[model samples]
Target: MFGPTYVFDDPMTLGPEPSSKIISHAHGITSSASKEEDASQIVIMNLAFNDGKFNGSALSVLGDYPFFQKYKEMAIVGGSGAFRLARGIVTAIIYTYNDTTQNEIIDFHVLVLHY
Candidate 1:
């Protein structure tokens, strides 16, 4: 679960490399994860957004870098606050276990809007 409670320390990284975005919230208050067993597995359960401006830039803090480009063109509906912001927000709970010694993992992004 990703929330305002899971705070990650500075110099964030899986091991020696620098992580793109480290957890920056306190635990058990907003979101919770089981990192004691398999630290690599990240579970983002919910994403909450406060009511305010609706600019595209406001969605930047929703998650980390390399967000899905397709989400920008999508739309969110329903009364639930979660869905209200989900339309423009792109949230992905990724679980990656890369062999750092063999290949360097790379995130690819492509933006396409057919309107």
Candidate 2:
């Protein structure tokens, strides 16, 4: 799936800002017959930021549980532009989950230390 990402001036206040936008695309293979089943998935995602920053990663999700006791961390193995040579971590938190719709909202926090 693909969508637009917004930035907020004051995240605590839910303020809005035109900071930058992102286009993301993910390709994956699912082991479950349907989303309602307990399964595992291997996915690769590519992110392109409007400010000329880009990053991509390959991640695996092994459990059907929607809530995590620990934040999931993925490697920022490659990137471009301001994030060139980026090597850091991307932490994921499940912000929301709807069992009826089988929809999940995840928040990602990226920390990059690059040259």
Candidate 3:
């Protein structure tokens, strides 16, 4: 699903205040887990920032998302616009998930360097 990601200025408050929006695309690929209950997927995500300080910039991520894991780390291989030639790591932790709605809230931490 491609959705709008709201950007918050402060992590502690995590208020309704959003400074910008990011369009995200995440494609899932079949994993090696044989059991149906143990299945997982490899995902690639591209996040394009649309406003505020990060407007026009984009970053790419590739990683494994285990069904039961609460925290995941992905590699940031590249980016565009203000983040051109970026490289770094992105850490994501699951905040809340809903099985019936198939919606989830994740907290992300990124450390990047660009030229």
Best by lDDT: 3
Cα RMSD of all models vs. native, in order, equals: 11.4, 9.1, 7.3
Write one digit per residue (lDDT tens) for candidate 2, span 49-112. Answer: 4322343332222222223344666566666565566677667676667799975555666677
By descending TM-score, how would the candidates be arranged? Answer: 3, 2, 1
> What does the lDDT come to for candidate 1?
0.27
For model 3, where is the 10-residue window of minimal lDDT? 8-17
Model 1 ranges with Cα > 4 A deviation: 1-4, 8-30, 33-56, 60-87, 93-115
Each prediction's whole-model lDDT (CA): 0.27, 0.43, 0.62
Judge candidate 3 at residue 95 and give its lDDT. 70
> Model 1 clash pairs?
5-25, 5-26, 6-25, 6-26, 7-25, 7-26, 8-23
lDDT string for model 3 (37-109, tens) is 6445555666666556776787876776666777788888888898899999988787777799976666777
As for candidate 3, its clashing pairs are none
Indicate which candidate wins on TM-score: 3
Which runs in model 3 stand beyond 4 Å of their true positions? 1-38
Worst 10 residues of 1 by lDDT: 54-63
